[model samples]
Target: MNWPTAAGSDSRPDPDSEYWDERQETRPPGERRDEIIEKIGEQVRYAYDNSEFYREFYSDVDVDPRNITSFEEFEQLPILSSDDIKQEQKEHPPFGRFLCIDEEDIARIYGTSGTTGRPKVFGIGQDDWDRIGEWHAQILWSVGLRPDDRVIITSPFIQYLGSWGALAGVDHLGCTTFPFGAGMEGQTEQAVEWIADLQPDALYGTPSYALYLGETAEERGHDPAEDFDFKVMFFSGEPGASVPSTRRQIETMFDCEVVDQGSMAEMTPWMSNSGCRHLENGMHVWNDIVYTELLDPDTEESLEYGAEGVPTYTHLERTSQPMIRYWSGDITTWERHDETDCECGRTYPTLPKGIYGRADDMLVIRGKNIFPSQIEDQLHALDDYGDEFRIVVEREGALDSLQLVVEVADDAETGPDEFHDLVRQEIKSEVGVTPDVTVVKQGELDRTQFKADRVKDKRELAIDV
Candidate 1:
């Protein structure tokens, strides 16, 4: 199939045309904030006027949406929690009081996986769907996927909205999308064979799936780095892509650039803050579309640059089920674009390290705090270990035990006995808690084609018993 490409000397797009919307992306910081504030006023007023949820939400807080004009006023508004959405959805059935558009105007429906509980739902208007595609296209373009790129979306077309958004952006960009969905029997094998046969230019899926695909390709006797023609791989649905060692591993396996992009399901346009082609650990926040804030999780006040805080998102353009001050539990440190001097020339706020993990995911063990990413970074940094791993936290008598079950790669030079202490010492130095590191043979640990739930906390089960 033929694909469209812009006029450039090389196969890639011209460097001058790097940004999808140069004027909007590179707008002065002062001007961008002013624009965001203006949009905030409009969205708030629209939500209050249209949706009963916003009307009552604002009413209960004794704050008038009409009174909110500046960014400061917007910050003063009440924050929306995931629990709040779940409760409202349960009480209201399908779309809650947050449904702004008329039922007849609804164009599409999507929701969370609900693996934990009843899924939170969202109703999308046609205009909003179009905008979602446009915003995603901007992010994809920023990460070096040109119109000529042949993209393969490995995520399934399921209740989750991650893959659909990528499909929309790829379609919008006029890229040839091979929607080779995952999770079916023999799907990973097929994905590997197809990549070898067709040679797609890019791939989109969770970081774990990308890694698994590399392993699958290897098991099938195909060297992923040499066999595939992928120039870039973008991931969502997990923090592995943002982890330095994991990113390095994927890049090495696929011989491609890895870009990390995603957020909570409530924010359907999850690519609000995505990686730019230029910077490592750089994800620029498209604040104009979705007004994003890094607020102190406890105080709900805006955080300064370089401070770790919860990512709070307020939809500036979403009309149907607009999320205002939605507190996503994910934690990360951010800096201003000017501070990073990103080569992309976009003045959007950048999450320099991408997302660290959810605030709730942190484990307090033996009076020491630890995150799964900390262990993951240390584990993948070693040459002997494979990408698959499991973090099991349990309460043993009076103390907490952190157990790491990891897979040893097939081509490792040394045995697990020789390298086990090296793994234990590296993790101890980083997270301050020494874990019981158990090394298993390759392919011993379970693998998932979607988000990998690496951490299994047996403490809750112990408490229940």
Candidate 2:
């Protein structure tokens, strides 16, 4: 299939909305700071007025919200960590004081993906949900998705924000949606049938799950690339979509353009960042709606533009539960855009590699810091290996032994030992650490319906909150 031409637009990229500076996405950083500083003060004051928890937390910090005039001073107000939110909700039972909406106005309540720990609950009012859908449409339309397209969502639509927000986006564009919930007994076969019957132009699912569906379609005597008329493959909830090799593999299997995204449950499913036509591999942060800062993982200081750090977030427009200075442990790096222009001509800030790793998931093995995304990148680049693989970490006496257990192709030209040696040498060369490589036969690893269990760290999980 051919890559789509730059095709759609959203008027949301305005020059100004809030006090003539909300258009920071298109303006230069130096010019935008003044307005951002103003909004920061207003946001803190709004939180202090609307949420009791913020008032108490700020009171404990012995600081006045009125005195917070700059970004540094605003950051000094204190960080709202995920674990802290979870504990507060536990103490308060159900929703906590962090919520900005009243009980009567709460339009919907959703739980976190709970991938890392206990799921933190979040809510949205009617207006909040509308804004989310509208913001999502901006990204969708920016990436060439249009109203006339037929989209099929394979993600679960219960209380999870992923499925719900995706459908909301389709609504924003007035696109037709076929909600095929995930993990149902005959979901795969049924999805294949729908692809054959309705002929959708787009699909929404996790990267691994989408890859598995392509495999399933082929296994059930159907040619995925031939039968499917898909043009866009929108993915989130995992790292595979952003990895170069994985992107290529999925595109080849389904014959579509892959656009990756970054979002979290507590942050609300507005899709804070998304891929645009300009940077197919990189995702642009919705600076107009969300303020994202990368902080040095060790020092907690803001990292330089090119430096990799954890993404700390603030929901600029979210009213139900505005996450002000929520320290997200997810690791990434970003770059500012200029009028020099992307292929699509939008000047939004871009995450160069997207969300590659998390600070909490970092592994120290044989004096080298490793992340599951690195191993995943290596596995995807290998032509003979299948999409499924897992990273296993075991304690070998005093030292931790790292093993990359990957699956080899069914019709392999090289023996298992030779393939293993190649992977070992390549990983050592790329990641600067030698790893034990085990080549399993095809279909040895588990096929996941959602996020794949990539890193299995059997060593004691001691991560400080």
Candidate 3:
């Protein structure tokens, strides 16, 4: 697919394709590691010299940016957290001192999700914008997207990077993109009808919204698989599309291959579970652009391949807002396989098992740690409960209690008492905690057009009020 560029704009290289080939051709993981460290050293030195934020951060550390040799020495530098970004923006107002380029160079602006606090504003210069577009193109190609295909993107197009990145990638692919950006307005319905009338060959959005569209189509007696001619589904923003049961449900409803693409607002789109002929291993890391390290969540020590822990990332190509040894608050495991031949023989380093779960998403309830995925897995195992559910955590008499509110098929002929008992017993067996289970009426809970927030912690309300 031809990469997209504006009129008179210099033609940008297809870094995605180049990245895929370069990663596969690299000797061993150790050799790839050495190369990554060397490249990152150069970027770090540049950022330290040009960006004032990094200069002050490293001023007291006494390590010369030029002399910093190994990743271990790099780790000796203090970790940059989202709080640091927020504090910097708070002190400086508007854009912080991290900008290496002048204001005129910036082509786009975006903000963080602000799940923690006030959203931190970020700017992408013209060059960085082009780099982001190239990254998206690579992601699209990796997930089997083609230029001739028509795809509907249902993500919100505000200050968020995901929607724009997807649009740019589709444009790069030379695909006929139906920019059906988020919100279930008249336009969304129109977009669905447009999809039906136009019969886009692919779909993109959160898993929840995709399911909602499928339900809408079914209500109109139009099966998405039979009528829409959708061949592929690309999903992000949540773990649903990557989870086995959720992925199966979406694929079954849409009759397409469901692939998971992962990225953050701060970091460029770098990793994804694409169609590599094998497809069963983990997601492939774009090692050329971003270097990844798996660390023990508790000790913060680096782990070997196949070890499960939180993911730390270093952006190799980012010149605007450089992130070096940034902890990405997500939990995952990596597997290194030496399979040389496959249906698609591009040999980049693969994850084998996709992202396990988010480190921040895990909850410590009743002295036992549990993840939403654990609850999701148990719920999916039960045939009586519907896939839609939420986990509510609250303190009951000084003890933390979890409530599992699930939707079930109305025609199942099972009462709330029976369903409650089943969930309580099943959760006890699986999670070692007997959670209070409530069977909500089907369609009672609110549906989302974006990432579904399944876990809600209400513990703050019990602060002696």
Whole-model lDDT per candidate: 0.85, 0.77, 0.72
How would you encode candidate 2's per-residue C-alpha lDDT over 249-305 as one tens digit per residue? Answer: 888988889988866767765476888644668687776567777788777787767
Displacement of the residue 158 alpha carbon in candidate 2, Å:
3.1
Candidate 1's displacement at residue 16, Å, is: 5.8
Q: Which candidate has the highest lDDT of all?
A: 1
**Least accurate 10 contiguous residues by lDDT in model 3:** 1-10
Residue-wise lDDT of candidate 3 within 1-465, one digit each (tens)?
111223223343353343334454445667767777777777788788878898898888857875568887877776777778889989986678887777788788888777678888888777767766666766666666656678888888887777887887778667788887887565556666888888888877877888877766776678888888888887777776656767777788878888776746677654333434246434666665677777889888888876888777777766677777778788777656454323454545565546647887888888887878777767766767665898999988879998989988677566778878888898888778889888887677777778787888998555673
Q: State candidate 2's TM-score.
A: 0.91
Question: Residue by residue across 1-465, what tens digits does model 1's lDDT show?
Answer: 011112111132454588777788888989888777777787888889888887878875645697576776787789999899999988887988898889899999998888789888989888788778877877888888888889999998897799898998888777899998899989999999999999999999998899889988988999999999999999888788889999999999999999989876788788887897887874778888777899897888888898999999988878788899999999999988878856878888888888878989988898887889888888889988876789999988888999998888788897888777888888899988888989898899889999888898988788543
Error of 2 at 397 (Å): 1.7
Native-referenced Cα lDDT, model 1: 0.85
**Pairs clashing in candidate 3?**
24-347, 281-352, 282-351, 282-352
Candidate 1 clashes between residue pairs 3 or more apart in a chain or in different chains: none
Number of backbone collisions per candidate: 0, 0, 4
TM-score of each: 0.95, 0.91, 0.89
- 2 or 3, greater by TM-score: 2
Ranking by TM-score: 1, 2, 3
